[model samples]
Target: MNTSNMDRCLRAALLGIGLALIGAPAIAQDAPVEDAAAPVTESAAAVEPPPPEVQAPSLEQAYQREFAFLQGQKADLERRLAELQDRMGAEQSELEAEIRALEAEVVEMGGEADRLEDRVFESELAVDTARENTDVLASTFLQADFSLAEAYSPDLGDRAPAAEDVSGLFDAALGVLRDAGSIRVEDGEFFLIDGARVDGRIVEIGGIAAYGVSPRGSGVLAPAGDGGLKLWNEDTAEVAEALAAGRAPDSLPIFIFESTATEVEKKGTKGLFDVIRSGGVIGWIIFYLGLLGLALVVLRVVFLQRASASTSKILDAVSGHVRRGDASAALDVLKRKKGSTSRVVSAAIRNLDRDREHLEDIVSEAILHESSHLNRFGAFIMVIAAVSPLLGLLGTVTGMISTFDVITEFGTGDPKLLSGGISIALVTTELGLIVAIPMLVFGNLLSGWAEGIKDDMEKAALRVINQYYEGRARGVESA
Candidate 1:
């Protein structure tokens, strides 16, 4: 049967064999004992010992029977085991085959699923592409309709077809484009420059430009902040008339406009004063400070010029006088001469009788005194240079503050409101830099020039002192 039934039968056969083997020896022993215990049962003993064939089975025979039975049962169990093994092998093979079949089916399904998924993905992609193309078409139609409406008329009305009618929209747009390219004259009323409305024949060269030939005045046409035309310039009357009469003018005086709903005013070039005014009060203040700095620079230049005048000639004259041992003449020459170099040389000459160290001290003192005039306005000019940028920074801070204030009040909707403050901020800073840079450069240059003048004066005085001493030495040697 099955493995479980075969296993039960094999266990039962083994248990029976074990019981027979265990009882066989006890049965043989008991039979002999019983025969002996019978005492006068000699008849029974004799009857039992009558024949081996009629005697009870001995333990050896019983064991041989049990062994034979056990052998038979073992043979039967072995046969059943073989049948179970064969059945199990068959089942295993069938299961393995089934498993393989299922695995193949699963693999096939996986490939099919992959193919299906690819197909689904492609379908989805196609759908998305179609949607995108539909959106593009709709947007194109809307844009075309809007462009046509804005260029030709305020409302498309029946001229613009439905959004779904793409061909109609394109056809209408093309027609409008063709019409716009050619000059078309139409009877219309337009406003003159003096705000008087007059009937006119409007000559439209294209969507970009138009010209009006009115009874009152004929010139180029511009948008009047309404769906109407206005006289832009009276000088273009000839061109407007030529276009109206279907004559091509040699020159086109055209006022190009994008829309008739908004007026475009020609912007004038701003002068220096207008730009400065746009910077507000701070900008004006910076401008004035720049002027002040410039004036200071000029004053310092004049002072330095006067202080440095004829320095070489003064040195030569004093040196010649000192060389001749005419100290008094040298002093007279110094007195008549003007400028820092002459004064320094005079101080050296007056102190010629003194010791060398003392004469040098006098010359240095004279040079120092003249340096005050040479350094005049230099510090103020530098101060202006330093202050101008700081004022600019202050103006910048104030301007930004005002800009923020405007933003806070108006919510930054109109850029014009914010531009004023921004312009002030930038203009003030620009002006400040413009003022500061030159002032700083010139201030440093003038200071360096003043230092150079002082050096020259010291050199002139030293030359005079050397000449005086040399002359004295010669005079003393001659004596």
Candidate 2:
């Protein structure tokens, strides 16, 4: 049955049962009550009301109605239960389909995850290799003395270079190679790996050579054994200038070493004495002679300084005494004074009693004698000045001979051996000039001083002799 019919049937059956139960109660109440006292009268009989007929529902009919209603409800319940079961079944099927789809997706996602992991592993290895290669390239640049790269080296330190740093290095290397034959100057530094760090201006000639100079010092940079730089005591001024000027003449030689070997490092700048010593034995002889000449110069200067003072006053006093026929007084004045001039005057005064011509001869003799004393050690100084340069020449000749002898024995294959002779040849000649120039200057100066003093003495003696003649003539006139 349909739900509506079943509901109507159930409602009708309940209504009938309710009506029967209510009617029963009403009919029982309506029935006359039996009285204990009996009193029947003609008036009571006439007023009596008749009882109404009320029927109760049949049991069979009620049972049939209830049964039919129950049947209809059961069918309706069955129909609804069927519908709910069908709905639950459909929902279960859909959930199962969704679960299957999710399962497949999980499996596919797992495979994709594995692939991503593999790719990530390969990427890691590539990164590691790149880092290692970068390290090696940086170390090569330092060891090879690439000065331009040194400017960026300080930032690298002992760490792996970043992508940017690698790219920058590549670009810089290409740029350097483009101008490989040209000279370049850059602000850079020298890292000794474990030693000192020097910051200065660096000069480079393509890839062949590099040098650094600062207020501290200057030296060529050479590849070190420990992947760093070493300072070599080599002159590279031409290269430095070319680098600074950004150009060079082909004839100007750069700092290209003979064999890429590290040059010997000197302690400091060599002095004049050191250069002389490099000339060897001959150098020493020239140096010693120079010292002797210097000593003689000092002594002669002192002697001349003392002897060349003003002597005209002493001469005047002596001449006055000689003119008055007072030879003893002139002698006393000469004894009191000191110098070559005084001695000359004393000698002339002692022979004043001689005739005028004889007096003149004696004075001349005295002045000649004083000249020897004035010229003391003058010849020795001249000899020293002349000998110093000759000794230097002797050193040069000996050095050259030694050089040629080395060539004959060894064929001059090694410049170091050849340099031994060359240094001696050049240095000794330099030392000789160094010695001779000063000695010549001072020697001549001392000689001039000595000659001036001698001339003074001759003048003083002649003045006294002339005065003596004048006084003697006056005496003759008085006679």
Candidate 3:
């Protein structure tokens, strides 16, 4: 039998035994007294009481017992569950407390960060305020110094002083004056003052008006509406000569005031002339170059621009007068004419008997002398034209250097910062070309004209020789 079968058999035997013990009657199985036992069975049965019988339990009692057992089990389960719940709640409380502590730490850290940020912001503000104070120019009247008389009561005249006290006072005043700063500048921007439009204290002279001398040399205070400088002649307003607008040549502006009169120190104006001189070196060079070219042009116009008829007029007049037997008139005409041809002809006429070939040589030499005088200083203009552009190129090199410096210092993000060097480069080049072109062109043109005149002089000298000396040779042959 398998284990399950054996177990089942055991459980069945136990159940049957319990049932037999509870309900079954006892049976006698003896053999000696069997007849006796058998004859006395009915009476013994009555005398021996039947085995007491057991009844089945009632359904109500069984149900009550089962219900009580289940109730006890449920009570034990409730006790265990309550213990587990209490342990879990304690753990949850500890975790929550830890979380609260961490949150408080985080809040404290955040407060520290805010405090540091506030300190940084306050420091930055202080630094910005300091920088602004340093950079700002004095912008209001409160920053300016008031005059001594304005600051003090005007009773200095009431106190009399000894000679030593006066000297000491003068010395003290001088020291104060020496230590005093520059005159206060006015904030001249247009602002609404009272109700009228008034300009700043900028002095200007009028073109249409004249200023007479001040009366008794008093202050030149003029009223706002009348007796002031006239911009133009008008019938409406009562106008007079006074300081007015516009800076014209030969105009002067006089400023006068009570209390005290202030003037611009003009401290930086002394170098104005030097600045102009430095900037104008190129201009001076160009001007001198032009003047030199003009001089050469005048010389060429004088000697080279001579009339072609100069020799012919004299030669024709001389031949005509000679045909009429008027040698004196012919000589007079020759004397009036200029240039080598007339001179040679006049010399030949006067010398008459010299070797004709030698006289030709003399005329040639004189023509060369006149050519030299015509071309004076003509080469200098050529040099100026050649060098001017080179000078401009030098300026361009310097400008590029300065331009790179500006880029390094200020950066090229804005083109206006670089424009100054560009102006220098471009303006110099333009001026150079402008100056060189005229000089180069006119200088060569004048030179070519001088050369042509020299050639003409040579030709005229040969013609004069042919007319005078060649004729004399033919005359000797005729004789």
Candidate 4:
């Protein structure tokens, strides 16, 4: 029906025709030979008569032979088709198996891709967390605002930190801790914003605190606005020693900076008088008491000095007149002399006519009288000396009470508010000591001088009396 069937029929017909032609040729040749042989054989006898019954192949016979030939060719074509079909089936089976294997591999690859995506996501999250932690650690562990930490910190951009960056952060934190514990003296140069430079061995106490020991002097280190180190105006020997020895002494407090904290060339202009003035009214009272004591001291000193000279001269004049046997002259000299010594000597000369016992009695009275005059106002000076300190103490107590009142009203938070009372307490006490020491010392000295003058006057008066009695006895003996 189809082209395949048509082609098969054509092939069969062609084969049949080819076979028929070949058979026709053989038949023709056989017929000619038989005819010839029969003719010959007819002459030979009756044997040829049965051969003459043989005839040419009918058309039906030829068709039968051609059909059989065509059938054989069809069988061969069918066998070839069967072979081709079998080979095609085998190839199809192999292709299907390969396709199934490829599908399974694709599924597996998809699963693997999903797992890789998840892992990548997790890795990204971990990196983000690590970056956040690093930032917090950098800010907390190291005070970022401080110059030292700011200098050491790395400038990471917006990206998260890698594994290496995290490791570096840990290293930096460890380094900070190590620096905090360890002490070192380094020879370095420090610069200031104002173009000041210092060359010295910087004593680093962890990076939190720094001090420098230089040929110039020792001082604290402070950070400038320009992120450079500037030596603070304040310094102490104790701090320098501690830094040099790599040991901090107990009770080390914060360093007190100067007026503006930047003025290194000059200190604040506060004198001792300012300190005293800071003490309020109580301090002023204490100060005036001290002045009064000083005044008394000066007056006592002047009086004692004058008494000393007058006593010496009076004794000399009276002794000379009595030794020359001129009692009236000695009395006149005693009257003319001006001092406690002269007064006492005049009393002794007036009673020269009396017996030695009466003269001694009169001289004793005169010496006692003159002793009072010599010691006049001496007690007032000592009292002033003693009272000045007590007044200062009163001021100190009052100031302390005032300070406590301030504390009760407000806490000890503001030193400025409390400083007034404290200054008063301390300054008054200091002024009291200042006033009391000289007063006590000079008072005792003036008292000693007064006693010496009194003693001198008494001795001179007794000697004059003795000489006068001796002269009288000598005159009696001569009579």
lDDT of each: 0.83, 0.74, 0.54, 0.72
* lDDT at 463, model 3: 56
Considering every candidate listed, which one attains the maximal TM-score? 1
Report the error of model 3 at residue 235, Å.
30
Off by over 4 Å in 1: 1-121, 144-164, 316-320, 336-338, 355-358, 390-412, 473-479
lDDT of 1 by residue, 314-403 (tens): 877777778887889888887888877777787788778899888889988898888788888998998889998888898889889999
- Candidate 3, after superposition: displacement of residue 135 in Å? 40
| Model 1 local distance difference test score | 0.83
Q: Give the winner by TM-score: 1 or 3.
A: 1
lDDT of 2 by residue, 414-444 (tens): 9888888889988888888888888888878
- Per-residue lDDT for 1-479 in model 4, tens only? 24488567866776677677668768767877876665454455655443444475666676677678766777887888889999999999999999999999999999999999999999999999987888876564346325336335655555554677667666776777787677788887664335568687777666556666666656676554343456664445467557677776775534333222343343588786676687667567767766777777777677777877886677667776786678788877766677777787788887777877888888888878777777877787788689778877987897889899999999999998888788778878887778778778878988998888878878878877887778877878888
List all candidate RMSDs to the true structure: 7.1, 32.6, 22.9, 38.9
Candidate 2 positional error at 350, Å: 1.5
Error of 3 at 282 (Å): 2.2
Ranking by TM-score: 1, 4, 2, 3
Worst 10 residues of 4 by lDDT: 257-266
Give the TM-score of each candidate: 0.69, 0.49, 0.37, 0.51
